[model samples]
Structure formats: C-alpha cells, structure tokens
Target: MTDATSRDGTRSGSTAQPVGGAKGPDELRRQIEQTRGELGDTVEELAGKADVKGRAKARAADLKDRAGAMTVHLRGSAGHTVRGGAGRADPPSRRARHAVRAGLGHPRAVLVAGAAAGVAVAASLARRHRHGPC
Candidate 1:
C-alpha cells in the first residue's frame, strides 16, 4: 500500500495555503462594517413592507390572550400548591421560619454573621474615636 504523504513531501490531508497573506485587523473591521451595513439595509426593507397598524392590533390581541391564559394557569398552580402545602401538620409560615432558622444555623451563615458583626463593631469604634470617646 502507498503511504499517505503527497508527491511534494507534505501530508496528503493538509490544506493548501491561500494565494495572499491573512487579512489585517483594519481590513477585517471594514469587512465586518460592510456586512453590518448590508444587513441593516435588508432589515429596513423588510420593516417597510409590514402593515404597522394591523400588525400592532394582532400583536396586542395575541399578548392579551397569552396574558389571560398565563394568569389562569398561575392561579390554578398556586391554588394546588397552597392546598397541598396546607395539608401538612406544620403551618406554611411556621415551616418557612423553621427552614430559615435551620439555614442560619449553618457554619457559613455563622461566619457571615460574625463578619458583619465585626464590621459593625469596627465602624462604631471609629465613630467613637472621631467623636472623642462619646
């Protein structure tokens, strides 16, 4: 079987080089600007063809219908959640408070509380020093 190397001693799968050097940053920026200008013109042409008043009315009706549907869905979901949550022995408010207390009991929470206390103490000391030991 023949090896994969080409007749020119380069790898057969390698790409051929471009005729010119790579484009510089300024040329690249110009190309990007040209493309953006063309795209902007295309968008403006498309926007001009649309019927503004009719489109606005249709969009407003669509949004209103969607909002009404969403309100009904959320109301049903909230009712279900409240009913399900209420069936538990612990009341929702008490349960939430207990959860918050438990979270605050963690080491990270204690560390954050300690840091805040330290800042407050330092600020108070600085104020006392500034006011000549009030």
Candidate 2:
C-alpha cells in the first residue's frame, strides 16, 4: 500500500504518462478567436470582389426578357384561339375544299394527311399541357 496502488496491487504509473503539449481551455479559446478573425478577413476580401450590383442588374435584365417572352407568348396564344374560332365559324373556300377532297379521295394521300394532322394535334396538345393554363 501506497495510495497509488489498486486493490489488486496494480500501480497507476504502470499505465499512465504525463500529457505533453496539451492546450488548456484558455489557449483553445484564443486559437478559436484567432481563426474567426482570419475567416472574417477572408470574407471581407471576397465581398470586395463580388460585384453585387452588377449581378443584380443582370438578374433584372433576365427577368425583363422573360416577361417580354411571356407577353409575346400570351399574344400568340390569344391570336391562335381567335383564329381557330373564326375558322370553325366559316368553312374553307370551295377551291381548298375541292383540293382536300381530291387528296382524301386517294387512299395513300388520305393516310398521309391523317397521320400529319394527328401528329400536329398531338404536338399542340403536348405543348399546351406542358405549359399549363396557357
């Protein structure tokens, strides 16, 4: 018995060594503060070169272009609906009717025209569905 000896007679010194180059709480706090100061300086340097105003101007221009495109798209859509209604109200010219009838009278031509019209209608519906409400 010494106080360092366990009940089984193992000594503390047999498995323990003095810690060297270990930082205490105050030293760790100081290192953290120094790192934070360096990070702040780096952030300031980056901010100086960021061109925030220029980026904002570019974003505004992009939004303006999109709005213009939307206006054009809406106008075209309205025009198309108006024209479609007009076409439904009034039948085609006699010459056009005769031409279509002549084309439809041929089996191969009729198939080709039907396929083309189907593809066109499918494409139009697909675009309308993709855009939503327009």
Query: How would you encode candidate 1's per-residue C-alpha lDDT over 1-134 as one tens digit per residue?
Result: 43365555544344432333238888767767987999999998888667698778888999999999999999999889878977556779998999789877797987888899999999999999899876
Each prediction's whole-model lDDT (CA)? 0.78, 0.78
TM agreement with the true structure for every prediction: 0.33, 0.30
Q: In candidate 1, how many Å is residue 76 off?
A: 0.6
**Candidate 2 colliding pairs:** none
Best by TM-score: 1
lDDT tens digits by residue: candidate 2, 23-122 = 7888767767987999999998888669789779989999999999999999999889979887554346866888878987797988888999999999
